[model samples]
Target: MHRMPTLSLPMYDINHQATLGLTSALTTLLQQRGVPAEVSWPQDLLPHWRDDQLLLSQTCGYPLVELLPDVQLVGTFLSSAQGCDGQRYRSWLVVRSADENLTLSDFRGRRAVCNSNDSHSGFNSLRYVIAPLAQDGKFFSATRFSGSHRQSLAALRAGEADIAAIDCITWALLRRNFPQELAGLEIIGETPLCAALPLITSAKTGAATLEKLRSALSELTSEKRYQDLLAESLISGFNVSDRAFYDEVREWKDRAAALGVTAL
Candidate 1:
């Protein structure tokens, strides 16, 4: 017997309760269409997508571009937030609002934090913006990984770090749901916009199965209950994404490398 197809949304699972609810609703909808689906939150989602049993998941543009030939783009999410226009999103270079004397240049030789080295909105976007300003491929006096945008914000707030690059969609959601956490933070700079995270299925997933997945996403907005879930998740809808859309991210990486600021 074939194992049930699995789906995961590890990238946007910051709000555990809400993510579970949203994915559960999607799973229910898929099952109703005779597509047996189950939700799984693996410890590390990057490797999980390579599983032949994988049916669906969302991944960052950097990984999506780097991990090509392993995963196939299925769709992209359009968030109902500022800094997001359709499937394009940007990153905000943020510092504590109280740091009145600081500017983007002032961040040089200071501590900086990012969600991960492989995150487009968290690291690559910020690197692309800072590359020209960077000297000898170096900008910050010290840099560290907080593992997620939310943590990066906290590190800045607690004085553990001087600044962070936050995904604008994550920042907007935190502003709406947890305003207290962001009360003293402000965006000091923004990176050029790039395609947002794209949904993916195993390269082995067949055309018919991919069509079923796309159909389910299109039907999400038509129902009131699912609409509510989408709002809670801060997602407006999904769109068919072109493979060329992520080329900008690859270009940014190459540009940064040329400037000698290849890693954060």
Candidate 2:
């Protein structure tokens, strides 16, 4: 038997039964493809523990681009129920509770919650949308990190937060799976769509290996069962995305710095 490489996965995806399912199934798929890799869905930022054994790591909007600079981005998807292609990517500003009929102007002196400080859709993209209206400390009286997107959504549900910059992809998935959870909330507005999260690979891997992996992913939806699973997770399809696409996100970050919104 030949040895296989391991890939650490995010627990939120698995716990939510989002895209990927049980570890056994994932491992089997990898082994069948000749890349015996292990998948771990831990709850921490993957870049912190990234090692040579990691073939790929999953992360959200900005953190993925910031944290893993060397890996090759593989898959990209829109949050607002769009497919893997960036064509339909969108953003939504969600109020923490139904009673908080806060307008976009009401962001002032209120707490703002994001998935992470480095998230593009969660922070950078939102920054671009609010740049015109936000004043230094008035727009957001305070900011908090709910760690994961789910936590941020939960914070809104529990009234622990005032507003959250939610990715349209996750929001759509929640709306499909748990409509009751999002019963009273309203989308005040939408931000310009940013590039979707790309599934990435390290440069250390061989191009042939990468090609084979890409082919496998391309065909993931061809199988009926897999297609249904992805539909359940709100994934439209997998598509190829290059690193240059993320440069715009970097440029946005640079512009934010120029405006003293360096936190983005």
Candidate 3:
């Protein structure tokens, strides 16, 4: 006998309203197939990602390639967010809108912030954008992790950091949920478009259950009934994928490293 674990939509859970809307639809879809599902928010996703009971969740590309090799890749979402196209997404290098006249090079020796080193959109994409401009393995005067993308935006707003790289999907969500946070920020540049977040489930899931999970995602995007819900979540479509589809993300990291730079 097999039991399905809770469904966790943790990555872009920035807005509770949106998260709830999505959770409701997904739960209904899964339940229709006799997959008992409920939303659970794990404070630390690393351990939860590896748990044998993990049913389905979205994770960034960095972790998919570097960690959690055993986690099954479910699929990738085709986000309708501003910086997304097809199955690819990019980052916006943000600074105060007051710096409109300043270019990327103008911020030399200034501070930068990101969500985490493990985050693909926040740190990896950001590092790839500036690795070419680095000197002696250094780019910013100081670099720090602000914990989350919204915090990084707030840091720029509060004058704590000169610039930060934020995922464009997050940028759109903040615009809808908390527009004031971005009131005075502008995108100085856009990073290279790489793979979007990979949806994953536990490797311990039976093949029959795995297909159900994948089918739920596939129908979520293709069906007209969920179109409105998808629009609300900034998801335009969904693409079937495996771990090999995320090789581009790791390539970005390798390209950055080849520049003789480490961190940003």
Give the best candidate by lDDT: 3
Tens digit of per-residue lDDT, candidate 2, span 136-227: 72367677888766777777777777777777767766677767667556677677666777666665778876876667666664466676
Decide which is better by TM-score, 1 or 2.
Answer: 1
- Tell me how candidate 1 scores on lDDT: 0.86
Which order, best to worst by TM-score? 3, 1, 2
As a whole number from 0 to 100, the lDDT of residue 154 in candidate 3 is 87
The C-alpha RMSD of each candidate to the native structure, in angstroms, is: 1.6, 3.2, 1.6
Can you write out model 1's per-residue Cα lDDT over 1-264, one digit (the tens) per residue?
Answer: 978778998887666788898788789778877788778988887778788888998889998888665787889989987888888999988999887457788888888999998899889998888898899999888888998998998899999998888988888878878888897888888887899999999888888888988888888755776877888878898898877899999999999999998886
> What is candidate 3's local distance difference test score?
0.88
Instruction: State the TM-score for model 3.
Output: 0.96
Question: Global lDDT of each model?
Answer: 0.86, 0.64, 0.88
lDDT for 101 (candidate 3):
74
- C-alpha positional error of residue 5 in candidate 3 after TM-score superposition, expressed in Å: 0.5
Q: Deviation in angstroms for 228 in model 3?
A: 1.8
Q: TM-scores of the models, in the given order? A: 0.95, 0.84, 0.96
